[model samples]
Target chain A: MLTCKDFLSELSDYLDDSVDSEIKAKLEEHIKACPNCWVVCDTTRKTIQVYKGQTECSIPLDIHARLMAAIEKKCAERGK
Target chain B: MSAPGSEAIVSEESGDLALARTGDAQAFANLIQRYEGKIFRLAQHITQNREDAEDVLQETFLKAYTHLDQFQGNSKFYTWIVRIAVNQALMKLRKRKTDRTVSMDEGIDTGEDIVAREIATWDPSPEEQYGREELAEILDSAVQSLAPAYRTVFVLRDIEDLSTEETAAALDLSIPAVKSRLLRARLQLREKLTKFFKHKGDDAFAYM
Candidate 1:
Protein backbone atom coordinates (compact mmCIF):
# COMPACT_ATOMS: atom_id res chain seq x y z
CA MET A 1 0.00 0.00 0.00
CA LEU A 2 1.32 3.40 -0.93
CA THR A 3 1.41 5.99 1.83
CA CYS A 4 -0.34 9.35 1.41
CA LYS A 5 3.03 10.86 0.57
CA ASP A 6 3.61 8.18 -2.04
CA PHE A 7 0.20 8.91 -3.56
CA LEU A 8 1.13 12.60 -3.63
CA SER A 9 4.10 11.84 -5.83
CA GLU A 10 2.09 9.97 -8.44
CA LEU A 11 -1.20 11.90 -8.15
CA SER A 12 -0.63 13.75 -11.40
CA ASP A 13 0.00 10.74 -13.61
CA TYR A 14 -2.93 8.99 -12.01
CA LEU A 15 -5.24 11.90 -12.73
CA ASP A 16 -3.73 12.41 -16.17
CA ASP A 17 -4.77 8.86 -17.19
CA SER A 18 -1.13 8.19 -17.87
CA VAL A 19 -0.71 5.62 -15.15
CA ASP A 20 -0.78 1.92 -15.99
CA SER A 21 -4.10 0.33 -15.09
CA GLU A 22 -2.85 -1.71 -12.18
CA ILE A 23 -1.08 1.20 -10.53
CA LYS A 24 -4.13 3.36 -11.16
CA ALA A 25 -6.32 0.94 -9.27
CA LYS A 26 -3.98 1.01 -6.33
CA LEU A 27 -3.94 4.82 -6.21
CA GLU A 28 -7.70 4.97 -6.50
CA GLU A 29 -8.06 2.53 -3.64
CA HIS A 30 -5.72 4.60 -1.49
CA ILE A 31 -7.69 7.77 -2.08
CA LYS A 32 -10.97 6.05 -1.36
CA ALA A 33 -9.80 5.20 2.13
CA CYS A 34 -7.97 8.47 2.71
CA PRO A 35 -9.98 11.69 2.98
CA ASN A 36 -6.93 13.91 3.12
CA CYS A 37 -5.53 12.56 -0.12
CA TRP A 38 -9.00 12.48 -1.64
CA VAL A 39 -9.57 16.18 -0.98
CA VAL A 40 -6.16 16.93 -2.40
CA CYS A 41 -6.96 15.02 -5.58
CA ASP A 42 -10.55 16.28 -5.94
CA THR A 43 -9.65 19.89 -5.26
CA THR A 44 -6.81 19.72 -7.73
CA ARG A 45 -9.08 18.34 -10.41
CA LYS A 46 -11.64 21.09 -9.77
CA THR A 47 -8.96 23.73 -9.74
CA ILE A 48 -7.94 22.63 -13.22
CA GLN A 49 -11.58 22.67 -14.29
CA VAL A 50 -11.91 26.19 -12.93
CA TYR A 51 -8.85 27.35 -14.75
CA LYS A 52 -9.97 25.70 -17.97
CA GLY A 53 -13.26 27.55 -17.71
CA GLN A 54 -11.64 30.98 -17.52
CA THR A 55 -13.21 33.29 -20.09
CA GLU A 56 -11.02 34.34 -23.00
CA CYS A 57 -11.08 38.10 -23.29
CA SER A 58 -11.15 39.49 -26.81
CA ILE A 59 -8.38 41.88 -27.89
CA PRO A 60 -9.81 45.39 -27.77
CA LEU A 61 -11.01 46.65 -31.15
CA ASP A 62 -8.49 49.50 -31.26
CA ILE A 63 -5.61 47.17 -30.57
CA HIS A 64 -6.85 44.76 -33.17
CA ALA A 65 -7.20 47.58 -35.69
CA ARG A 66 -3.72 48.88 -34.95
CA LEU A 67 -2.26 45.41 -35.42
CA MET A 68 -4.02 44.89 -38.72
CA ALA A 69 -3.13 48.37 -39.86
CA ALA A 70 0.52 47.91 -38.94
CA ILE A 71 0.68 44.61 -40.76
CA GLU A 72 -1.02 46.22 -43.73
CA LYS A 73 1.58 48.95 -43.66
CA LYS A 74 4.36 46.38 -43.68
CA CYS A 75 2.76 44.62 -46.63
CA ALA A 76 2.48 47.91 -48.51
CA GLU A 77 6.16 48.52 -47.84
CA ARG A 78 7.09 45.12 -49.28
CA GLY A 79 5.08 45.97 -52.37
CA LYS A 80 6.92 49.31 -52.86
CA MET B 1 -10.90 16.68 -46.22
CA SER B 2 -10.83 15.39 -49.78
CA ALA B 3 -11.33 11.71 -50.53
CA PRO B 4 -8.33 9.79 -49.26
CA GLY B 5 -6.62 9.46 -52.62
CA SER B 6 -8.07 12.52 -54.35
CA GLU B 7 -5.78 15.22 -55.68
CA ALA B 8 -7.99 18.13 -54.58
CA ILE B 9 -7.57 18.81 -50.87
CA VAL B 10 -9.76 21.29 -48.97
CA SER B 11 -9.84 22.93 -45.54
CA GLU B 12 -9.96 26.66 -44.98
CA GLU B 13 -7.17 26.23 -42.46
CA SER B 14 -4.98 24.58 -45.02
CA GLY B 15 -6.03 27.02 -47.72
CA ASP B 16 -5.27 30.00 -45.50
CA LEU B 17 -2.00 28.35 -44.55
CA ALA B 18 -0.98 27.99 -48.17
CA LEU B 19 -1.71 31.62 -48.93
CA ALA B 20 -0.10 32.85 -45.73
CA ARG B 21 3.05 30.93 -46.58
CA THR B 22 3.33 32.71 -49.92
CA GLY B 23 3.47 36.18 -48.29
CA ASP B 24 -0.22 36.90 -48.82
CA ALA B 25 -0.70 39.31 -45.93
CA GLN B 26 -4.49 39.10 -45.96
CA ALA B 27 -4.38 35.33 -45.59
CA PHE B 28 -2.03 35.71 -42.67
CA ALA B 29 -4.38 38.23 -41.12
CA ASN B 30 -7.19 35.75 -41.44
CA LEU B 31 -5.12 33.24 -39.58
CA ILE B 32 -4.30 35.77 -36.87
CA GLN B 33 -7.96 36.69 -36.47
CA ARG B 34 -8.80 33.13 -35.51
CA TYR B 35 -6.00 32.82 -32.97
CA GLU B 36 -5.15 36.25 -31.60
CA GLY B 37 -7.55 36.11 -28.64
CA LYS B 38 -6.37 32.69 -27.57
CA ILE B 39 -2.69 33.49 -27.95
CA PHE B 40 -3.18 36.74 -26.11
CA ARG B 41 -4.82 34.92 -23.22
CA LEU B 42 -1.91 32.53 -23.05
CA ALA B 43 0.59 35.38 -23.13
CA GLN B 44 -1.35 37.25 -20.47
CA HIS B 45 -1.38 34.19 -18.24
CA ILE B 46 2.35 33.69 -18.34
CA THR B 47 3.60 37.27 -18.39
CA GLN B 48 1.07 38.24 -15.69
CA ASN B 49 0.91 41.76 -17.14
CA ARG B 50 -1.18 43.11 -19.99
CA GLU B 51 1.60 45.23 -21.51
CA ASP B 52 4.14 42.42 -21.63
CA ALA B 53 1.56 39.92 -22.78
CA GLU B 54 0.49 42.21 -25.65
CA ASP B 55 4.09 42.64 -26.67
CA VAL B 56 4.55 38.88 -26.68
CA LEU B 57 1.36 38.41 -28.67
CA GLN B 58 2.42 40.92 -31.32
CA GLU B 59 6.00 39.68 -31.48
CA THR B 60 4.83 36.08 -31.83
CA PHE B 61 2.78 36.88 -34.91
CA LEU B 62 5.48 39.09 -36.40
CA LYS B 63 8.06 36.37 -35.89
CA ALA B 64 5.73 33.71 -37.20
CA TYR B 65 4.94 35.73 -40.29
CA THR B 66 8.59 36.43 -41.00
CA HIS B 67 9.43 32.76 -40.67
CA LEU B 68 6.23 31.33 -42.13
CA ASP B 69 8.20 29.33 -44.68
CA GLN B 70 9.94 27.42 -41.91
CA PHE B 71 6.68 26.00 -40.53
CA GLN B 72 6.26 22.35 -41.31
CA GLY B 73 2.65 21.22 -41.90
CA ASN B 74 2.90 18.11 -39.76
CA SER B 75 1.14 19.93 -36.89
CA LYS B 76 -2.05 22.01 -36.92
CA PHE B 77 -1.35 25.65 -37.77
CA TYR B 78 -2.62 26.91 -34.40
CA THR B 79 -0.42 24.39 -32.63
CA TRP B 80 2.60 25.70 -34.48
CA ILE B 81 1.63 29.25 -33.68
CA VAL B 82 1.02 28.51 -30.01
CA ARG B 83 4.50 27.07 -29.63
CA ILE B 84 5.84 30.39 -30.80
CA ALA B 85 3.59 32.30 -28.41
CA VAL B 86 4.76 30.18 -25.49
CA ASN B 87 8.35 30.99 -26.31
CA GLN B 88 7.59 34.66 -26.60
CA ALA B 89 5.76 34.63 -23.25
CA LEU B 90 8.73 32.93 -21.61
CA MET B 91 11.15 35.39 -23.18
CA LYS B 92 9.06 38.28 -21.88
CA LEU B 93 9.03 36.77 -18.41
CA ARG B 94 12.78 36.28 -18.50
CA LYS B 95 13.31 39.88 -19.61
CA ARG B 96 11.50 41.04 -16.48
CA LYS B 97 14.00 39.03 -14.39
CA THR B 98 11.03 37.18 -12.89
CA ASP B 99 11.24 33.74 -14.48
CA ARG B 100 12.03 30.95 -12.01
CA THR B 101 13.70 28.69 -14.65
CA VAL B 102 13.40 25.49 -12.61
CA SER B 103 12.65 22.10 -14.09
CA MET B 104 10.40 19.78 -12.02
CA ASP B 105 13.33 17.65 -10.94
CA GLU B 106 15.42 20.64 -9.96
CA GLY B 107 12.43 22.53 -8.61
CA ILE B 108 11.48 19.85 -6.14
CA ASP B 109 15.12 18.77 -5.70
CA THR B 110 13.84 16.31 -3.11
CA GLY B 111 10.17 15.47 -2.69
CA GLU B 112 10.73 15.41 1.08
CA ASP B 113 10.32 19.15 1.27
CA ILE B 114 6.53 19.00 0.89
CA VAL B 115 5.27 18.12 4.33
CA ALA B 116 1.69 17.00 4.66
CA ARG B 117 -0.83 19.45 6.11
CA GLU B 118 -4.41 18.84 7.14
CA ILE B 119 -6.86 21.00 5.19
CA ALA B 120 -10.65 21.25 5.43
CA THR B 121 -12.60 20.54 2.28
CA TRP B 122 -15.34 23.13 1.73
CA ASP B 123 -18.82 21.59 1.86
CA PRO B 124 -20.14 23.54 -1.11
CA SER B 125 -16.95 23.13 -3.14
CA PRO B 126 -15.27 26.20 -4.60
CA GLU B 127 -16.90 26.80 -7.96
CA GLU B 128 -20.33 26.17 -6.48
CA GLN B 129 -22.03 29.16 -4.77
CA TYR B 130 -18.79 31.15 -4.70
CA GLY B 131 -19.49 34.42 -6.47
CA ARG B 132 -18.24 34.02 -10.02
CA GLU B 133 -16.19 37.20 -10.03
CA GLU B 134 -14.51 36.44 -6.72
CA LEU B 135 -13.74 32.91 -7.83
CA ALA B 136 -12.16 34.16 -11.00
CA GLU B 137 -9.97 36.51 -9.04
CA ILE B 138 -8.81 33.76 -6.71
CA LEU B 139 -8.15 31.39 -9.57
CA ASP B 140 -6.03 33.93 -11.39
CA SER B 141 -3.96 34.68 -8.33
CA ALA B 142 -3.47 30.99 -7.57
CA VAL B 143 -2.23 30.29 -11.06
CA GLN B 144 -0.01 33.36 -11.06
CA SER B 145 1.58 32.33 -7.79
CA LEU B 146 3.13 29.25 -9.37
CA ALA B 147 6.78 29.36 -10.38
CA PRO B 148 7.32 29.89 -14.09
CA ALA B 149 8.19 26.25 -14.77
CA TYR B 150 5.00 24.87 -13.24
CA ARG B 151 2.71 27.72 -14.31
CA THR B 152 3.65 27.28 -17.98
CA VAL B 153 3.01 23.56 -17.80
CA PHE B 154 -0.33 24.08 -16.02
CA VAL B 155 -1.44 26.69 -18.56
CA LEU B 156 -0.40 24.63 -21.54
CA ARG B 157 -1.68 21.33 -20.23
CA ASP B 158 -4.72 22.15 -18.14
CA ILE B 159 -5.94 25.50 -19.40
CA GLU B 160 -4.76 25.37 -23.01
CA ASP B 161 -5.70 21.67 -23.31
CA LEU B 162 -2.45 20.85 -25.01
CA SER B 163 -1.71 17.13 -25.04
CA THR B 164 1.11 15.93 -22.82
CA GLU B 165 3.33 15.28 -25.80
CA GLU B 166 2.44 18.61 -27.35
CA THR B 167 3.13 20.44 -24.09
CA ALA B 168 6.44 18.62 -23.84
CA ALA B 169 7.41 19.54 -27.38
CA ALA B 170 6.38 23.17 -26.94
CA LEU B 171 8.35 23.58 -23.71
CA ASP B 172 11.33 21.45 -24.84
CA LEU B 173 10.92 19.24 -21.81
CA SER B 174 10.72 15.46 -21.81
CA ILE B 175 7.30 13.81 -21.46
CA PRO B 176 7.99 12.71 -17.89
CA ALA B 177 9.27 16.17 -17.12
CA VAL B 178 6.04 17.74 -18.28
CA LYS B 179 3.98 15.28 -16.26
CA SER B 180 5.96 15.94 -13.10
CA ARG B 181 5.73 19.68 -13.38
CA LEU B 182 2.02 19.62 -14.09
CA LEU B 183 1.41 17.37 -11.11
CA ARG B 184 3.44 19.55 -8.80
CA ALA B 185 1.69 22.62 -10.08
CA ARG B 186 -1.75 21.18 -9.40
CA LEU B 187 -0.78 20.05 -5.93
CA GLN B 188 0.51 23.44 -4.97
CA LEU B 189 -2.52 25.20 -6.38
CA ARG B 190 -4.84 22.87 -4.51
CA GLU B 191 -3.00 23.62 -1.30
CA LYS B 192 -3.35 27.33 -1.86
CA LEU B 193 -7.05 27.19 -2.66
CA THR B 194 -7.92 24.96 0.25
CA LYS B 195 -6.96 27.81 2.57
CA PHE B 196 -8.95 30.31 0.55
CA PHE B 197 -12.19 28.30 0.52
CA LYS B 198 -12.34 26.91 4.06
CA HIS B 199 -14.27 29.72 5.70
CA LYS B 200 -17.80 29.54 4.27
CA GLY B 201 -20.54 30.97 6.55
CA ASP B 202 -21.86 27.96 8.48
CA ASP B 203 -25.45 28.15 7.23
CA ALA B 204 -24.40 28.21 3.58
CA PHE B 205 -24.28 24.44 3.58
CA ALA B 206 -26.48 23.56 6.55
CA TYR B 207 -28.76 21.45 4.39
CA MET B 208 -25.87 19.20 3.44
Candidate 2:
Protein backbone atom coordinates (compact mmCIF):
# COMPACT_ATOMS: atom_id res chain seq x y z
CA MET A 1 0.00 0.00 0.00
CA LEU A 2 1.32 3.41 -0.96
CA THR A 3 1.23 6.18 1.61
CA CYS A 4 -0.66 9.41 0.94
CA LYS A 5 2.66 11.21 0.58
CA ASP A 6 3.76 8.78 -2.11
CA PHE A 7 0.48 9.28 -3.90
CA LEU A 8 0.76 13.03 -3.68
CA SER A 9 4.40 13.08 -4.69
CA GLU A 10 3.89 10.77 -7.64
CA LEU A 11 0.55 12.24 -8.60
CA SER A 12 1.90 14.30 -11.50
CA ASP A 13 4.00 11.45 -12.84
CA TYR A 14 1.14 9.01 -12.38
CA LEU A 15 -1.25 11.34 -14.14
CA ASP A 16 1.28 11.78 -16.92
CA ASP A 17 1.80 7.97 -16.97
CA SER A 18 5.53 8.36 -16.60
CA VAL A 19 5.84 6.36 -13.41
CA ASP A 20 6.97 2.77 -13.22
CA SER A 21 4.36 -0.02 -13.17
CA GLU A 22 4.92 -1.08 -9.55
CA ILE A 23 4.63 2.47 -8.26
CA LYS A 24 1.65 3.08 -10.47
CA ALA A 25 -0.09 0.05 -9.00
CA LYS A 26 0.68 1.21 -5.48
CA LEU A 27 -0.58 4.73 -6.28
CA GLU A 28 -3.76 3.31 -7.77
CA GLU A 29 -4.33 1.25 -4.66
CA HIS A 30 -3.85 4.32 -2.49
CA ILE A 31 -6.27 6.34 -4.63
CA LYS A 32 -8.88 3.58 -4.44
CA ALA A 33 -8.57 3.50 -0.67
CA CYS A 34 -8.25 7.24 -0.03
CA PRO A 35 -11.03 9.64 -0.78
CA ASN A 36 -8.84 12.69 -0.12
CA CYS A 37 -6.28 11.61 -2.69
CA TRP A 38 -9.01 10.69 -5.11
CA VAL A 39 -10.37 14.21 -4.85
CA VAL A 40 -6.91 15.53 -5.71
CA CYS A 41 -6.89 13.34 -8.80
CA ASP A 42 -10.36 14.44 -9.83
CA THR A 43 -9.59 18.14 -9.35
CA THR A 44 -6.31 17.89 -11.23
CA ARG A 45 -8.01 16.17 -14.16
CA LYS A 46 -10.74 18.80 -14.27
CA THR A 47 -8.23 21.63 -13.97
CA ILE A 48 -6.16 20.29 -16.87
CA GLN A 49 -9.28 19.88 -19.00
CA VAL A 50 -10.34 23.47 -18.35
CA TYR A 51 -6.84 24.78 -18.88
CA LYS A 52 -6.58 23.04 -22.27
CA GLY A 53 -9.90 24.47 -23.42
CA GLN A 54 -8.93 28.01 -22.36
CA THR A 55 -5.64 28.28 -24.28
CA GLU A 56 -6.82 27.74 -27.84
CA CYS A 57 -6.00 31.08 -29.52
CA SER A 58 -7.33 31.87 -32.95
CA ILE A 59 -4.73 33.07 -35.49
CA PRO A 60 -5.89 35.53 -38.12
CA LEU A 61 -5.50 34.58 -41.79
CA ASP A 62 -4.02 37.94 -42.69
CA ILE A 63 -1.24 37.43 -40.17
CA HIS A 64 -0.26 34.24 -41.94
CA ALA A 65 -0.24 35.90 -45.38
CA ARG A 66 1.72 38.86 -44.10
CA LEU A 67 4.20 36.66 -42.24
CA MET A 68 4.86 34.72 -45.41
CA ALA A 69 5.38 37.91 -47.38
CA ALA A 70 7.71 39.30 -44.71
CA ILE A 71 9.78 36.13 -44.62
CA GLU A 72 10.01 36.21 -48.42
CA LYS A 73 11.04 39.86 -48.32
CA LYS A 74 13.76 39.12 -45.77
CA CYS A 75 14.99 36.21 -47.86
CA ALA A 76 15.09 38.48 -50.93
CA GLU A 77 17.00 41.14 -49.00
CA ARG A 78 19.46 38.52 -47.76
CA GLY A 79 19.92 37.07 -51.26
CA LYS A 80 21.10 40.42 -52.67
CA MET B 1 -4.10 10.57 -49.14
CA SER B 2 -1.46 13.24 -48.63
CA ALA B 3 -1.10 15.75 -51.42
CA PRO B 4 1.81 14.76 -53.65
CA GLY B 5 3.16 18.31 -53.69
CA SER B 6 3.04 18.70 -49.90
CA GLU B 7 5.93 16.29 -49.37
CA ALA B 8 7.91 18.12 -51.97
CA ILE B 9 7.23 21.39 -50.21
CA VAL B 10 8.35 20.03 -46.84
CA SER B 11 11.50 18.56 -48.36
CA GLU B 12 12.05 21.75 -50.29
CA GLU B 13 11.51 23.81 -47.13
CA SER B 14 14.12 21.77 -45.29
CA GLY B 15 16.48 22.21 -48.20
CA ASP B 16 15.45 25.83 -48.46
CA LEU B 17 16.30 26.42 -44.81
CA ALA B 18 19.67 24.98 -45.60
CA LEU B 19 20.00 27.07 -48.74
CA ALA B 20 18.63 30.16 -47.04
CA ARG B 21 21.41 29.85 -44.49
CA THR B 22 23.68 30.08 -47.51
CA GLY B 23 21.73 33.10 -48.87
CA ASP B 24 18.83 31.62 -50.86
CA ALA B 25 15.74 33.89 -50.88
CA GLN B 26 13.30 31.39 -52.44
CA ALA B 27 14.27 28.69 -49.98
CA PHE B 28 13.79 31.09 -47.07
CA ALA B 29 10.26 31.92 -48.34
CA ASN B 30 9.33 28.26 -48.08
CA LEU B 31 10.80 28.11 -44.57
CA ILE B 32 8.77 31.18 -43.56
CA GLN B 33 5.47 29.70 -44.74
CA ARG B 34 6.26 26.56 -42.79
CA TYR B 35 6.98 28.30 -39.48
CA GLU B 36 5.30 31.74 -39.46
CA GLY B 37 2.19 30.79 -37.45
CA LYS B 38 4.13 28.98 -34.76
CA ILE B 39 6.44 31.98 -34.46
CA PHE B 40 3.48 34.40 -34.41
CA ARG B 41 1.68 32.55 -31.63
CA LEU B 42 4.84 32.36 -29.55
CA ALA B 43 5.29 36.11 -29.92
CA GLN B 44 1.61 36.84 -29.21
CA HIS B 45 1.64 34.81 -26.03
CA ILE B 46 4.71 36.63 -24.77
CA THR B 47 3.71 40.18 -25.75
CA GLN B 48 -0.06 39.72 -25.19
CA ASN B 49 -0.72 42.37 -27.87
CA ARG B 50 -1.38 41.73 -31.52
CA GLU B 51 0.59 44.70 -32.80
CA ASP B 52 3.60 44.02 -30.58
CA ALA B 53 3.28 40.33 -31.36
CA GLU B 54 3.45 41.07 -35.08
CA ASP B 55 6.50 43.21 -34.54
CA VAL B 56 8.19 40.50 -32.51
CA LEU B 57 7.23 37.91 -35.12
CA GLN B 58 8.76 39.96 -37.87
CA GLU B 59 11.88 40.75 -35.87
CA THR B 60 12.33 37.17 -34.70
CA PHE B 61 12.15 35.66 -38.19
CA LEU B 62 14.39 38.31 -39.63
CA LYS B 63 16.92 37.70 -36.85
CA ALA B 64 16.59 33.96 -37.30
CA TYR B 65 17.12 34.31 -41.02
CA THR B 66 20.22 36.37 -40.42
CA HIS B 67 21.60 33.95 -37.85
CA LEU B 68 20.34 30.70 -39.37
CA ASP B 69 23.87 29.45 -39.81
CA GLN B 70 24.36 29.47 -36.04
CA PHE B 71 21.47 27.05 -35.46
CA GLN B 72 22.97 23.84 -34.25
CA GLY B 73 20.96 20.66 -34.79
CA ASN B 74 20.79 20.24 -30.99
CA SER B 75 17.21 21.53 -30.99
CA LYS B 76 14.46 21.56 -33.56
CA PHE B 77 14.06 24.56 -35.89
CA TYR B 78 10.78 25.39 -34.16
CA THR B 79 12.56 25.52 -30.82
CA TRP B 80 15.16 27.89 -32.24
CA ILE B 81 12.48 30.23 -33.56
CA VAL B 82 10.64 30.15 -30.24
CA ARG B 83 13.81 31.16 -28.46
CA ILE B 84 14.24 34.11 -30.76
CA ALA B 85 10.64 35.24 -30.24
CA VAL B 86 10.88 34.90 -26.47
CA ASN B 87 14.13 36.87 -26.39
CA GLN B 88 12.60 39.54 -28.59
CA ALA B 89 9.55 39.78 -26.35
CA LEU B 90 11.73 40.04 -23.25
CA MET B 91 13.77 42.79 -24.86
CA LYS B 92 10.57 44.66 -25.70
CA LEU B 93 9.30 44.19 -22.17
CA ARG B 94 12.51 45.59 -20.76
CA LYS B 95 12.23 48.59 -23.05
CA ARG B 96 8.60 49.16 -22.06
CA LYS B 97 9.11 48.66 -18.33
CA THR B 98 8.03 52.22 -17.58
CA ASP B 99 4.56 51.35 -18.86
CA ARG B 100 4.29 48.35 -16.55
CA THR B 101 4.62 50.68 -13.50
CA VAL B 102 3.85 48.17 -10.77
CA SER B 103 6.30 45.46 -9.87
CA MET B 104 4.88 41.94 -9.76
CA ASP B 105 5.08 41.79 -5.96
CA GLU B 106 3.26 45.09 -5.65
CA GLY B 107 0.81 43.99 -8.30
CA ILE B 108 0.01 40.86 -6.35
CA ASP B 109 -0.46 42.87 -3.16
CA THR B 110 -2.81 45.33 -4.86
CA GLY B 111 -4.41 42.52 -6.79
CA GLU B 112 -5.65 41.14 -3.51
CA ASP B 113 -7.63 44.37 -3.13
CA ILE B 114 -8.90 43.98 -6.66
CA VAL B 115 -9.98 40.46 -5.87
CA ALA B 116 -11.73 41.66 -2.75
CA ARG B 117 -13.54 44.37 -4.69
CA GLU B 118 -14.56 41.87 -7.31
CA ILE B 119 -15.85 39.53 -4.67
CA ALA B 120 -17.80 42.32 -2.98
CA THR B 121 -19.38 43.43 -6.23
CA TRP B 122 -20.67 39.99 -7.12
CA ASP B 123 -24.39 39.46 -6.68
CA PRO B 124 -24.91 38.33 -3.08
CA SER B 125 -26.27 34.97 -4.16
CA PRO B 126 -23.56 33.00 -5.95
CA GLU B 127 -25.42 29.70 -5.71
CA GLU B 128 -27.89 31.29 -8.08
CA GLN B 129 -24.90 31.89 -10.36
CA TYR B 130 -23.91 28.43 -11.51
CA GLY B 131 -22.15 29.44 -14.65
CA ARG B 132 -19.31 27.00 -15.44
CA GLU B 133 -18.33 29.28 -18.30
CA GLU B 134 -18.06 32.20 -15.92
CA LEU B 135 -15.83 30.19 -13.64
CA ALA B 136 -13.52 29.50 -16.59
CA GLU B 137 -13.47 33.19 -17.46
CA ILE B 138 -12.48 34.04 -13.92
CA LEU B 139 -9.75 31.43 -14.13
CA ASP B 140 -8.41 32.97 -17.36
CA SER B 141 -8.41 36.45 -15.87
CA ALA B 142 -6.50 35.17 -12.87
CA VAL B 143 -3.97 33.58 -15.18
CA GLN B 144 -3.62 36.76 -17.18
CA SER B 145 -2.88 38.68 -14.00
CA LEU B 146 0.06 36.45 -13.17
CA ALA B 147 3.58 37.82 -13.65
CA PRO B 148 4.93 37.36 -17.17
CA ALA B 149 7.63 34.87 -16.11
CA TYR B 150 5.16 32.77 -14.18
CA ARG B 151 2.50 33.11 -16.85
CA THR B 152 4.92 32.09 -19.59
CA VAL B 153 5.94 28.86 -17.88
CA PHE B 154 2.34 28.03 -16.99
CA VAL B 155 1.12 28.64 -20.53
CA LEU B 156 3.94 26.61 -22.05
CA ARG B 157 3.38 23.62 -19.83
CA ASP B 158 -0.30 23.65 -18.95
CA ILE B 159 -1.94 25.70 -21.69
CA GLU B 160 0.25 25.12 -24.72
CA ASP B 161 0.73 21.42 -23.89
CA LEU B 162 4.45 21.47 -24.54
CA SER B 163 6.46 18.64 -23.05
CA THR B 164 8.98 19.44 -20.31
CA GLU B 165 11.96 19.02 -22.60
CA GLU B 166 10.43 21.15 -25.33
CA THR B 167 9.56 23.93 -22.89
CA ALA B 168 13.01 23.82 -21.38
CA ALA B 169 14.57 24.04 -24.80
CA ALA B 170 12.28 26.83 -25.98
CA LEU B 171 12.73 28.97 -22.88
CA ASP B 172 16.41 28.15 -22.40
CA LEU B 173 15.46 27.23 -18.87
CA SER B 174 16.78 24.18 -17.12
CA ILE B 175 14.33 21.32 -16.66
CA PRO B 176 14.35 21.86 -12.90
CA ALA B 177 13.64 25.59 -13.33
CA VAL B 178 10.79 24.76 -15.67
CA LYS B 179 9.36 22.21 -13.24
CA SER B 180 9.67 24.50 -10.23
CA ARG B 181 8.14 27.51 -11.98
CA LEU B 182 5.35 25.39 -13.45
CA LEU B 183 4.35 23.95 -10.08
CA ARG B 184 4.52 27.34 -8.38
CA ALA B 185 2.44 28.98 -11.11
CA ARG B 186 -0.16 26.22 -10.92
CA LEU B 187 -0.27 26.50 -7.13
CA GLN B 188 -0.76 30.26 -7.25
CA LEU B 189 -3.53 30.00 -9.84
CA ARG B 190 -5.20 27.20 -7.89
CA GLU B 191 -5.07 29.22 -4.70
CA LYS B 192 -6.74 32.19 -6.37
CA LEU B 193 -9.40 30.05 -8.06
CA THR B 194 -10.04 28.11 -4.87
CA LYS B 195 -10.53 31.30 -2.92
CA PHE B 196 -12.85 32.72 -5.58
CA PHE B 197 -15.08 29.65 -5.60
CA LYS B 198 -14.92 29.05 -1.88
CA HIS B 199 -16.04 32.60 -1.16
CA LYS B 200 -18.87 32.30 -3.61
CA GLY B 201 -19.86 28.96 -2.13
CA ASP B 202 -19.84 30.36 1.37
CA ASP B 203 -21.95 33.32 0.32
CA ALA B 204 -24.36 31.00 -1.44
CA PHE B 205 -24.66 28.78 1.62
CA ALA B 206 -25.14 31.74 3.96
CA TYR B 207 -28.19 32.88 2.03
CA MET B 208 -29.84 29.48 2.35
TM-score for all models, in order of appearance: 0.86, 0.70
> What is the overall TM-score of model 2 with all chains considered together?
0.70
For candidate 1, write residues B1-208 as lDDT tens digits.
Answer: 1238434333776898899888888799988897888888888888899888878877888878878889988876777888999888877766775455633333453456343463556555567757888888798898898887888889888887888888888888899788877877887888887777764553466688
Best prediction by DockQ: 1
Which of the numbered candidates is closest to the native, going by highest lDDT? 1
Ten contiguous residues with the weakest lDDT in model 2 chain B:
B111-120
Tens-place lDDT per residue, model 2, B1-208, is 1357967765665777778777877676667766676667666666667888888888888888788889986776766787788778767766786647222222223212211111212223333355767865676677766777777777777766678888888777788667656655654665565555434443665566
Question: What local lDDT score does residue B24 receive in model 2, on the 0 to 100 scale?
Answer: 70
- Cα deviation at B86, candidate 2, in Å, is 1.4
Clashing pairs in 1: none
Q: What fraction of correct interface contacts does each candidate retain?
A: 0.57, 0.28
lDDT of 1 at B96: 70
